[model samples]
Target: MATFAELPDSVLLEVFSYLPVRDRIRISRVCHRWKRLVDDRWLWRHVDLTVYTMRPKVMWHLLRRYMATRLYSLRMGGYLFSGSKAPQLSSALMRALGQKCPNLQRLCLHVADLTTVPIASLPRTLKTLELHSCEISMLWLRKEQDCSVLPLLECIVLDRVPAFQDEHLQGLTRFRALRSLVLGGTYRVTETGLDAGLQELSYLQRLEVLGCTLSADSTLLAVSRHLRDVRKLRLTVRGLSAPGLAVLEGMPALESLCLLGPLVTPEMPSPEEILASCLAMPKLRVLELQGLGWEGQEPEKLLSRGLPHCMVIVRACPKESMDWWM
Candidate 1:
C-alpha cells in the first residue's frame, strides 16, 4: 500500500482543490510541501470571499498574497450590517481586483455599495456582472470612461437594486455587446425608459423584468417591435387586456415565455382569451403562468385547449415563504 506522503504533487493539489477556502487555509499549516501545493495559483482560480466577515486589511492581504493574476471568477460581499463603511472597503477591494485580476470573467457582489468605485477600476474582461441588493449612484452608470469599461459585457443582473432607474438603462446603451439583461424588483424604471433603452440594444436576446409596473401596450409593444431576436422573455403583467397581450405576436423568434404576478383582473381579459393569444404565436415552445388570481375559473381547463406542440405550465403561488424568483 502507498503512503499518503508518497502521493504525487498533482494528486495532492487535486485533493486540495475540493476543499473549501477556509479548510485549505487551515491545512496549509500542516507541512512545507502541503503549504506549497495549497498556495498554487491553479487552486485559487475561483475565489469566494462571501463566507467570512473579513476586515478590509485582511481581505487586502489575502488578495495580494493569493489572488494576484490567476483569479477568473470572484464573488464577494456579505457585509450587510456595515452600513457607512461598506462602500469604502468594497471600493478598495474592487480597485485591487482591477489591478491584480485582469482575466476575471464573472463577478457577483451581494449587498456591496458601488457608489465610490470608479468605472475604470472594473476589469474590462468581465462578461457577467450580478449586483444583488447593492446601492448604485447615477454617476456610476453615466460616468465617461476610456472605452474599456464593460466593453465585452454580455450579461448583467440588477436584483432588487433601488437606485436603478431609466437613466441607468439609457446609460447601458453604450454596451452594444450586451446580450442578456434582468431587471428584477427595479421599480423606478417606467415604460418610456424601457422602450427607449431597449430600442438601442439591437443585439439583446434574453430579457426578464419582474416586480415592476409595466404595461403591455407600451413596454411589451416596444419589446415586440425592437427586440426581434429575443429567444426567452419573463415578465409580470399587471393590467393588460387580451388585445394588449397581442403585442407579443410581433416577436417572430420568441421560444420561451414566463408570465407572473396577478394577471387575472376583472378589467383585463379573461384567462381563456390570454391563453388563446399566447397560443397564436408562431414559434412559442414553452409557456409558464404563475401567481395568477383566477378565483372562480378552472385554469387547467382553460389551458388545455389544443396546444399539442407547445409545453404549458399553469400553477398558483405557493403558500410557504420562498425566494422572490420562485
Candidate 2:
C-alpha cells in the first residue's frame, strides 16, 4: 500500500491542489518528496499568500526564478500586510509579481490598509480582481495604466474598501467586458459611484453594495432602478427603511438578493417590511437575510410570503421562520 508520500508527483499534485493552500503547504513540511513537489512551479502555479511564511524578499526571489511561468492567480489575506515591514515587503512583492507573473489572470488582495496601489506594476493579462477591505484609490485604476483592452476580465469584488471617488468609478468604464462587481464597505460611497459604474458597464449582470450610506430615500430607491439589468444584488446596512425596501420592489430580474445587517437599533426595520417589499420580485430565486428580526415583533407575516422556488438563508435569523425562509 503506497502512502501519500509515495504517490507520484503528478498524482500527488492533483490531490494537493484540492486541499486549501494552507493544508498543502503543511503537508509539504512533512518530508522531502512532498516539499519538493509542492515547491514545483506547476504546484505553486496559483499561490495563496495566506499559506506562505517566507520573507517578502524570499518570495520575490522564488517567484522570479522557480514560479514565474507557473503563477496565474494570487489570493492574499489581510494578515500578509499586517507585519511591521509590510511597506517594504508589499512593495517588493508587487514589483516582483508584476515583472514575473505576466500570464496572471486573477488577483485577490484583501489588505485592509493603503491609500494607493502600484497599478502600473500589475500585469496586463489580469482578468479578475477581488479587493476586500483594501485601501485602493479609484484614481490608480483610472490614471495609472496604459492598457485599453482586458477582454477576459469579468469580476471585480471591492468589499468594504474605503478608496472610491466619483472620478475613480468613472475609470472602471474602461473595462468594457466587466460583468460582476461586489462593493461593500463603510465608505461614504454615493449613489453616483454605483450609477457611474453601472451605466458604463454595458454587460454587467451582478452588483452588490453592502454598508453604504446612500444619501436619502430617493437616491437609495434610485439604486436598484439604476442597476436594472443586475440579476444578483446584495444591499446591507445598519438601518433599512420603508423607502429602501420600496426600491427593491422594482428589481424584476433579480434572482439572488441579500439584505443583511445587525439587528441592534431602534431604526432597524422589521423582517416583514423587507419581505413585503420584496414579495413582488417574480424572478427572485435566492433570498438571504442576516440578523432578521425586530426587538419584540413576530415574523410570521414575513415567513408566510416566502417564495418556494427561492433558496433562502436566514442566518442568525429567528428560528420561527426557518420553515418559511429555509
Return the TM-score for each candidate structure: 0.79, 0.74
Tell me the spans in candidate 1 whose CA falls farther than 4 Å from its real position: 1-20, 29-45, 78-80, 85-87, 90-92, 143-146, 262-264, 267-271, 293-305, 314-326
lDDT of candidate 2 vs native? 0.64
| Per-residue lDDT of candidate 2, residues 140-175 (tens digit) | 667345546455668877766666655666566667
lDDT of each: 0.76, 0.64
Give lDDT: candidate 2, residue 57. Answer: 62
Ten residues in a row with the worst lDDT in model 1?
317-326
Give stretches of model 2 more than 4 Å off. Answer: 5-36, 39-42, 51-54, 77-99, 112-118, 136-138, 143-151, 192-197, 215-220, 263-269, 294-305, 317-326
What TM-score should be assigned to candidate 2? Answer: 0.74
Clashing pairs in 2: 160-184, 160-185
Query: Largest lDDT belongs to which candidate?
Result: 1
TM-score of model 1 (CA atoms): 0.79
